[model samples]
Target chain A: MEKKTRVLLFKPGLDGHWRGIMTVSKALSEAGMETIFFGFKTVEGVVEAAIQEDVDVIGFSVHSGAHLEWARELVRELEEKGARGDFLLLVGGVFPEQDHEELREIGIDGVFGPGTVTAEIVRFIEENLGRKVSG
Target chain B: MEEMEEIRRGLEEWREAKKGWPERREEFRTDAGIPVKDLYTPLDMEGIDYLGDIGFPGQPPYTRGVYPTMYRGRYWTIRMFSGHGTPEETNDRWRLLYEEGETGFSAAVDSLTFSGVDPDQEVHGAAHEVGKEGVPLYSIRGVEALVENLPIDRMSVALVVEPMTSAAVTSMYFNVAKERGLRKEQLAGTTQNDILTMTIGYIPWGSLKPADLLKLACDLIEYCTAMGEAPRWNPINFTTYNYREGGIDAVQEIGMGLANAVAHIEELLRRGWKIDDFVHRLAFHLSAHRDFFEEIAKYRAARKLWYRLMKERYKPENPDAYRFRFHVQTAGSSLTAQQPMVNIIRTAYQALEAVLGGTQSLHTNSYDEAICLPSEESVRLAVRTQELIQEETGVANVVDPLAGSYYVEALTRELEERIWDYFMRIEEMGGVVEALNTGWLFNEMSKAFNKRRRDQECGAERVIGVNCYVMEEEEPTPPFRTNPRAAEIEKERLRALRAERDNRRVAALLDRLRGVCERRENVLPVVSELTAAGATLGEITGVYREVWGIWQLPFVA
Candidate 1:
């Protein structure tokens, strides 16, 4: 059997908008990734899930303007857990295009905003997984 | 079977008659999976009587219109939903709309208030949205300021709130009116006290369990029915607008709507309340989406079906209870952020369909909705869009203008059939409450939402400027930025109020609420008292949480 990549998808904020997360989760799973769904998780909960699942990527699907704060806390959480470099962190949802570079500067591997199709996210995770393992 | 075979044979011969015919798949269908015929004929709508089924305007079944003259008698209210920055800010916006010739008023609150949490207590909020996404209605004082100088007695108010927080908000509104010397009998307003939408559609911040919310909603209805003689307040607007945004098709939107209303009616009936006491005041919140004809048919079918449900099931004596009056909002989900200005044209078509479908009130989404709360310029354009429809276009001059068209009639009948089919299934599943509790409705919505998103992504479904007619690397307009100081000012105000208010009196009010809640008594009286006594939203909800416990249900899918 091939070593299929595993991804952890989490909802980090309050706006219980599940359409984006639900669609992305289904897409990742259908794209042959072992997806672990984490909802309403604190930054620590997300870090814990990522480490426990041994996921290659952790994606936070958030609404509102809280993505930056959540991503920062998540990066801090992973750094505190000593696994900051082990997993790639991607943040998606409702962020303005200008905030994308700032989010990546704060150690988010990639940023996907609203109207982003599922195929792009799936491909991004797969390619990032390849870079992580091959390196 | 023989006649069916003969027609099928003729169709096969007709197909063979064309030598260079295009290889077209005859499976063209609507978004709701209703098959679209090549051409509709009178045969498609057989066995349907026009007068008995639809009748004239302001007549039985109410399929034509709820009023005799329809828009000619009175134009549908242009109720633009505006709230942000603070209570005072929202109040100013409301006054502006009134000055702009808008008729109806809605007081909207931010997520923190809606979730039964104080703005100072937002857990996941980055502080950017505290009072800016909507008003920070954390205190009765704040709520009073929202409707302070406005005419509470005369205005047709629609509380832009869900059931989870409607109890607190509704009581607050009544208290404000009372303090302003307006009797409850003079109140003309609506509260969107829909529990199904609260639990399943808009996954709100954590609050009371679904069962407690249902009981609280019933309490409001009962209080309104028993207290004020000739009450004009609607205790609930069973909503499908919320559910539609969660990813169901047009059929399921109205299906869930009818089923959810049945759930509410059944619950109230079990309490031995007379149907006429509350059913007349029970309105609906529906959506006008991109499915133009389908949406029009959906509204027509809903009115016809609800008339039957109210007449046959409960048998209310008041004919007013049978007429369904609904408010429609152009679907925000249909708007695109890429070519945001195109949303104007999109909204124009949607608003037209809503008017054609006989909505009583309408809110056209601003072109900037997909990016942020509507900007003032876009909001004016939206209001003007409605005015244009009302004054310029004579679409609303006739009642049920599309009633006789073969496609519309067939689709309306088909939608009725599908809605009844849902009723049977929901009945067998015990009811809508059971369906919601078992996550059946949530699962159905999630599945639909996911599949629709995937289809749009893969070109199976088309959304302009999203997956089709697309622009590569298009520049997005600047997102609407919430004033950062709004949170700051609101949080400080909350702290000062807590420090200054009579904590003991607040405690007593909360205790009374808890007592009523525990005894399963009508909670609205105590809720009104609590709001009047300066009890903060968090404090009242704290008492409820202590009584009903907290529920943290995620979306089923």
Candidate 2:
């Protein structure tokens, strides 16, 4: 039996925009990935959960324009736990195109902004994880 | 009747003649999936009586306009919803908009404020979001700074907060007004105390139960309008605009709004209030979306339906209760991030729809909003978009200018019936509160979200920059970043407030609030005093959460 790629997604902090994250979760699940959507969690909590769940990818969405702050916090949390290189970290939400490089520099593997296609996200996950997800 | 018969015969010949000409698509439909015909004539409006169905403005069945003169008497207030970084920065932005001819002000609060958490709270990473989404009004000091040196006494202000913190936040503003030597009777503003906004639209953290939210919402209406505390203030605005931005169409938008309004009305009436007490001050905030004619017809249908609902059901003796006055905002969901300049043209056309629909107020979205908060230049352009419609365009000169158009009138009648049917479906499911508890409203929102995603992906709904006319290698628009020290500044403000205010007094008032919550009485009077005594929103909402308990949403991913 093929081991399904596990992905953990959440919303960091108190930002309440849920549609984008929920859509991505459903898309990844339909794409044959085991998605665990922890609705709202702290970066530290998400990192601990991802490590415990043995997820291949950890993703979070932010629409509160604090994307840089959140991205940095998540990376710091992962580094502090010695799990920075363990999972593919992804950040997606309503942020500026100019901030994509800064987000990537903050140790995020995937950065999806506004008008992102769900298929593009699935492809990014599959390609980066070194496995073809059969949907 | 003879004219209708002749037009019916003419429509049959025209339909046959049009069969030879190739149409643009196999089918034509409005954004709401209502089938559209190639042409409409008097036959389409045969049963719609002008006097009974489409009466003149300021009369029953206000299909034309809410007021008799409409924009001819005065232009719709250009009330922009804006806030960022800090209350001081937001006040500066308000001054800029006012200088640029904005008539009203709306405060958009940050996530911490929205969720009733202060920046200094121990909640996870709460400081990161302080003053990020909007201005942080945690205490009365922030509220005072937000309206400092502004003519709030004359111009109306809107506090875009939900029921969770509406009582506390609104009271903060009211207290600010009072200290500035203004009476509550002379104050005019709106509180976006819509229950569905938190439950469905944005889904704030630690939200109260649907029934408890209803109690909080009705508490405000009972305080301001029914109790005559702030007689001129609009205590609650049923903001369907927030919900519509989640991808619902025109029919679902108005349908949900009507059902939501009914929930509040029933709650207030149950609390021993007359129909005329609060219904007249019940305003709406609707969206102006892509469908030009359909959006126009939607405003008309909404006015008529509100009139019909009031006349047939509540029958408030106050004539103003039947008027469905609304503020229209150009659809934020319709704007695309790619080729952002095109959003300007899109906003212009939607603004025109609102003007033709006879909106009482309007807010045009900035072109760069799809990406980040609007820059000063971009927001200025957004204000100019509405200014162009009022100044350059002659559309607002006449009231409901398209009132007699065959397609518009027919579509209005069609939409009125469809909206009523959808509203009844909600009513059948035990109204808005029950539907919310059963997760039925969330299901509707999720369904709409998926459908819109699918439609856009498959090119069924062609967004100019996203799907069609794609632009590659475009220069990124310069993003407007909020103040980096906003969190630190807001935390300092809270710290200072705590040191200065009489802690004993605040604690005693909080105890009173807990008792009020236990008795399920109105929380306004005590909350007003608490805000004056420098109590934070987190403290006030904390009491409610402790007493009522937080709601666990029946949400599934």
Candidate 3:
């Protein structure tokens, strides 16, 4: 049997809107991924969870229009931890369509905004898993 | 008999029209799981008494509307939910919205406010929290700045806050009102005092536990009841918006809202407040979801069910007690960042549904909100969305335009029955507080959410931009730049306020609040006095934090 992919979903901001992440987590579970929701964590918290959970994917969702600052800080946090590019790093929630490329430059692996189908997300994770192992 | 024969012949024609329409691939149920038949006819609404089930506007059941002239008498208040960065920034948004002909002010306080922590106390270096989500209000002075220079008498101010902070936020308002020479009775505002919303595990913790929050909610309601006959003082807007957005369908939203309302009513009744005294002021913050008919029928059925429930069960003497006056906001969950411009159409339709469903007020989400906190241009455009509907479209000429439609009426009836079934299930768990605590309520929400997820995954549902319609390569929408220094500015203000305030006096007032808490007396009036005496929001909320410590959702987290 193939090993199940473990994904840690972190709400990396204080925005109390949870529908996006909750829905995505549900989708990941339905797609047969092992999911952990680190409810409302800091960037450091996200990086720490990546180490602790030994997960294949880490997705941060920031909806308060502060994703630029949050994403930068998370990249810095990962670099400081010497774990940059160790896992598949994804970002979601209320981001402009134009920022997907900039997100990749800033060390994010994939960008999933609102209305991106969960099935597509599952596929993204599946496709990205080998990259994490090879890296 | 002739009309029946004409309907039967029309039904045959409808069936013929629907034959081979190529819609087999579609899901056949509302989000509530009620099957959507190909055609609804007189047979669908078999025994619904028009007058009894769908009452006239302003009459029993109130299926049509709460007011005789819903928008014609005047329009529903065009409210845009606004708060971000500093109180100064939020105040700027308020001024702009008010100047742009928005009618009401809804305050969205920051996350620290929800936890009863002052910015200085807890969030010093938290980059994301510096008014990123909402204004960081920590004291009487904080709220004072938030509402500074507003025409208090002309506009109804609604605090879109939670339970534990109700007393603190209300005190901030009362103190400001006193400073402005306004009496308690002269105030008109609402506090989103539904702790049941908190228990849905949306937020990890509120400042207080479930039981404490309920007592505080009852206290605020009773405080408003005692305040002399000043109309429009909405004490509580029982919210199922967050719950529904959390994945529950329309039926559960109505049912949970009804159950939470009754739970408050029961508590207030036990405290010896007449149901008529406070029930008139009860309201709802209902979500306008994507299903146009389901959303419309949900609002209609909510009002009718509440009326019958209040009349038959509690028996309030005032007719106003039965009317479920709700403020609707477009479902934030329905917005999409892909082709973000399409969200404007989604919001317009949702706003129209709210207007047609006879909402007392409505808040339309901005097109770019799926990307961030609404930019100024987007918010202005959102405000314009409502104006276009109100001015351009003649939707408001008649009240409840879809009142007699066989499909709408059938949906409304089926929704009402299912809502009652939900109510019974809720009651079986001893009531809302127990249901929420025992994970029973979350279980229901989980089921609702899981069903929705399955539907989305299996292509049973189409979210336009999300599932079926492919925006192969999305154009780059404008990026939103957040104020990184908002935290420092807000904290500096807090520091200056703390320095200016008389510490000994503030401590004494908080001690008095603690005494009031111990005596089990009503907490609002005492806190109002302290706020008027120049105490901070953090100090007032600290009393609660001290009393309750911090509440944790052991089941989910």
Interface RMSD of 1: 2.4
Model 1 agreement with the true structure over B1-557: per-residue lDDT tens digits: 57656666776676678747764774788878999976666556567788888688888878877888998888898988788888888888888888888889876667677777776664655354576457878787788889878887779888877766677888887888888887878888888888877777766666567778888887777777645532888888887888898878887888788888877777888898778767888889899998889999988888888888987888898888889889998998888767888999999999998999999999999998876777677888999999999889888777789988989989988988998887778778977777877888778887888888878878888888997888765677777766667878888877888888888988888888888878988777787878887787777777777888877664567
Model 2 bad stretches (over 4 Å): B1-6
Which ranges in model 3 have alpha carbons more than 4 Å from their true place?
A1-4, A41-53, A72-86, A97-106, A131-135, B1-27, B122-127, B204-207, B227-231, B518-520, B554-557
Q: For all candidates, what are the clash counts? A: 0, 0, 5
RMSD in Å for model 1: 3.1
Per-candidate DockQ vs. reference: 0.47, 0.84, 0.42
Which pairs clash inside model 3? A94-B371, B85-B131, B138-B537, B139-B536, B139-B537
Say which candidate scores most in DockQ.
Answer: 2
lDDT of each: 0.80, 0.92, 0.79
Write one digit per residue (lDDT tens) for candidate 3, span B30-145. Answer: 86778898778887776999888987898888999998778889999988888887787789889999889999989877766765666665442244566777777777777888
If both were scored by lDDT, which would come out higher, candidate 2 or candidate 3?
2
Which structure is stronger by TM-score: 2 or 3?
Answer: 2
lDDT of 3 at A3: 69
In candidate 2 chain B, what residue range of length 10 has the lowest lDDT sum?
Answer: B37-46
Docking tier of model 2: it is high
Off by over 4 Å in 1: A1-3, A131-135, B1-25, B122-129, B552-556
lDDT of 3 by residue, A13-121 (tens): 5466565677788778867888898766777778887898798888877666666677788889989999988888888876676777788888888887766677778
